[model samples]
Target chain A: MSKNSMKESYKIKDNYNTSIKIKSLVITLICLILTIICLLPIYLLVINATRNTSDILNGATLIPGNETLNNYKNLMALDGFNALTGFKNSFIISGSAALLSVFISALTAYALVVYDFKLRGPAFTFILAVLMIPTQVSAIGFVQFMIKIGFFNTYVPLIVPAMAAPSTVFFIRQFMKSSFPLDIVEAARIDGSSEFRTFLTIGIPLLKPAMSVQLIFAFIANWNNFFTPSLIITRTEKYTLPMMINTLSSDRYTDYGMVYMGIALSIVPLIVVYFILSKYIIEGVALGGVKE
Target chain B: MASNAQRRIKHVSYAKYGYFFIIPFFLVYFIFSFYPLVNTMRYSVEKNLSKEATIYDGEFVGLDNYKHILTSPDKNAEDYYVHAGMREGFLRALSNTFKIWVMNFFPQMILSMILAVWFTDAKLKIPAKGFFKVVMYMPNIITAASVAVLALKMFSNDSFSIVNNTLLNWGLIDEPIQFLADMKLKRTIIAGIQIWMWFGNTMILLMSGIAGINPSLFEAANIDGANSRQVFFRVTVPLLRPILLFTLVTSLIGGMQMFDIPYLFNPGTNRSPGTQTIAAFIYQIYMESRIKNTGHSGAASVVLFIITAALGSIVFYINRDKDEIAAKKQLKKLRKQAAKKAHGGLGL
Candidate 1:
């Protein structure tokens, strides 16, 4: 009786048909295609950098070309543009904005979560209110203010304001609620550490994950920021990478080879950073998934 | 006992330290954020000759700039505020902005929702889920300027036009289509890019919403013999309402401020190429060093702010769920009844 039942069950298992397997195969193909679509443009960017301008007129294929050195030469010879200076300026601005904003925001988050302060509720509410106010509203006056205070055409306007990023502060506060505990601060206080010292030694280390996430976000936002800088930085020498790419595209005789090369160069840092922090970015999305 | 009480008071007074930590944020915000915001309002109503000119030097224009935005003095299609002849007018730019946003947003939400649901569906047995999520999000991280340049180069009716060529290769068209030239085509292409760049972001938000749902709920639905579509609509969609509202509202705000791609491709136009947005209009206004219409730009920015704020509030109001409100009321009533009963007897 047991053997017969075993045989019946085996027959039932075998009855699962080819149609289901084919369905799964189709689903796999669709998913793969979606991934490829996401990835293909970037591949095209890299591939196009190696092809000639005129040669590509016939229609550039996904296939690799032998014109990489020539395109690099073309990019180097492009007038009124310096990739090196743009990269340096971009790095300085984005790096400063990221570090300053994240640290200051974390500091602010630490304050709001750990202590009972006067105006705490109001200040937190103010941050929430300002988060709704998009940057464009004040951009006109910001540029005007920058000009009035002799701040235009300088990185001060770009880097300093990042110190008060309310969004970053809010995000860090959310992370702290779940991950950071108030008792840890009390423990440090009990052990006779200074308040600021406790934050540095105990609070910051715990908020590292949140810090990196905001730092990358702040960095990307600052790096890709073309609007404000376009209004402020009129000179070529002070151009950020995005601004440089815009200038390259807007030129009268836009060189396709040089443009592609410049674009490829601009995305390389972001792509590299993404590869390193891809896991964190995906995870961080969920972390920031819900608004508190 | 008095001394111990005083010591306790002092311990709690360490709350003063909170003020110290919080002050820097407020201070910086006051200078960089608050001050500019107030200054924007002030500048919007005045006629400043140039930014180099003092604020006091400018005449009070009252609502003239704002009025100028709405009631165009010249109904001419080709009228420009500055020598560059870029700005079409405030209203025209605004309409164009909305036009592009509407074209882009509907498609974006629909596609993002489908992609989000499909990728996260458990029964799908999707492969390389992590890889796809990361790659899809890659565009969001990269600069829009670079992406615009890539898009234009690939799609332009030139020898370097990969898209045009592919169509020709596949025998889809006899000639390379003028993607950047035709106004309608240009708007569609611009909208398409916006969709491409943002769907991943929306998908992740939806995925997080899906992840937030309890697994037992899905299991229970399965036990009831609910198919994927029914489960999605009945259980998942209802549970995901807040997330959906958040995405939709935020996307609208973002769409209104859509500048980078259109600005990159079609700079300093009023509403030319059908791709011009309000942001580009404002930027163009500021860029006009020749005319010095900062006040007009300020007015336009104010308008943009109002539109976004109004939509954002609507988001907040809708997201306040009705069932939750009723549940809270019921809980309060039950607690009140329990308290009365306890007072009447030893039912603690």
Candidate 2:
């Protein structure tokens, strides 16, 4: 009787396995379809960016056409499309913002984690609170503050505000708590290393993964920031990529191709950055997920 | 004595270094964020003209601007403020904001949880899971403004729109759908875009939660002859409670503050009240404040602060309750372990 029952159970298991395989195949197909849907806009944008306004208006296909180079040339000829200058401004702004934000956030995280100080809890809470206040909430005040401080229409307004990012501080603090082992710090202290020296020489080096995460986030935030620049920086010369794209789209003459090209160009740097630090970015996001 | 002197020196240096390490964040916070925040509150009460000119000319009109914006009639002598509108514009914006929040949150949460469960299943040999994750998160990195523009082109009312063309070709609809032109459809599309942009983050969070679950629990269930569905429902969902609650609260707070997408979608004109959220309303007020006629943007700012604070606190309170409950369970487990050790045997 026991042998018969075991054989019957095996048969049931085999059938279940076959059904599971069929279900898995269906789910995988659905997931692939969803991925394609998510990528559709990107595909269309790339295709349209290459086509001229006439072709775009005339219902272009998903495939590339002869107008790719012509559209790019036209886009380059536009007032703000001096590729050299545009790139220089974006690089300087995004780079400085990322560096400043990451450095400040790291130091803040270090203090919060390593030091037992009064107001640490409250400060951490305040940082979390500030994360909920959207950038638009303080836009009017921020713009006015920048103007009053004589940083209007320059990189200072663009870069300085991002330096004290509350979310970055919060994220880095969490990372430091989990990843920065106390034993290492204790060992370093035992070796007669000064706290400042330890941080600079040991802590910072060990914090590459966290730093990369913060750097990518800061870079992306600053790179795509539009409203602040739109409000504070009226000069065309100082416009970031997003602001430049906005100008291209909203100007009296709406050049669809140029706008698409500008949008495409604006996103390429981020994609490249993502590929370079894909490992760190994925881990950071995954870690952030668990903590939350 | 040598050790004591070394320790003293270390203590002094550590304190000084701590201050040094903290100075950059504090200085930047004061100069950039905190100062501006305080000034926003201050300016909400004062009157300003042009870039350089501002005065505390008005008597402290506490909540008058809020009342006016929330309760005032439009120039056409119609009551523009809906019942839900407090502090500015019509109430429809607030309702619309909540509506979009509802539309996006439920589906996104459910789908993410389902995906997380499926991805973690042992039977699945998902190839390049990491690659898929990166691709999924691609939309999150894109600028909301650009995404809005792309959506506009793709959902255009014209026949050239890919969505409409595809639908027509498939005989899904008799004619082209006016996606953005219609108010309900526009809001739905906006919510859809938000969900697509946000689900990857949710999926990642849920996946992490699933990963953290102890495998032994699943193994035990399997040994007991439990089916996949039973094991998942019994173990996975319950273990993911904390992360799920965290995501829910954060999503709630973030959803209430939705701005960038809606603003980009409805650029210059306020054509559809359906799409205008509280953030967009605030933007409109700020823009209007630049003109001489409308001098009450500061009031709108004050209103926004109050609403955000109220909502944020409520959500925090809800999350805190769940956290305390979890803490209590952990404490109970610790006590039980201590009792067992004291007794030198497991309780019957």
- Interface RMSDs of all predictions? 3.1, 3.3
- Please write out the lDDT profile of model 1 over residues A1-292, one tens digit for every residue: 6999999987776664444456557867876786787778888888878887776666667787888888888877877777888989999999998899889999999998888777776777677667767778888888878988888899998899878998798889878877787887876766678899999999899999999888888888898888778878988899998888776665364566667888898987789889899898878776653221
The digit string of per-residue lDDT tens for model 2 on A16-117 reads 888988888887777887789778788888888888887776664788656778767877888755544666787898899999888888888887778666
Top candidate by lDDT: 1
**B91-114 per-residue lDDT for model 1 (tens digits):** 567777888888888987887777
Error of 2 at A56 (Å): 2.9
Model 1: residues with Cα > 4 Å off, grouped in runs? A1-23, A289-292, B1-12, B51-56, B72-88, B267-273, B314-348
All models, RMSD in angstroms: 5.0, 6.0
- TM-score, predicted candidate 2 vs. hidden true structure: 0.86
Q: Could you say which candidate leads in TM-score? A: 1
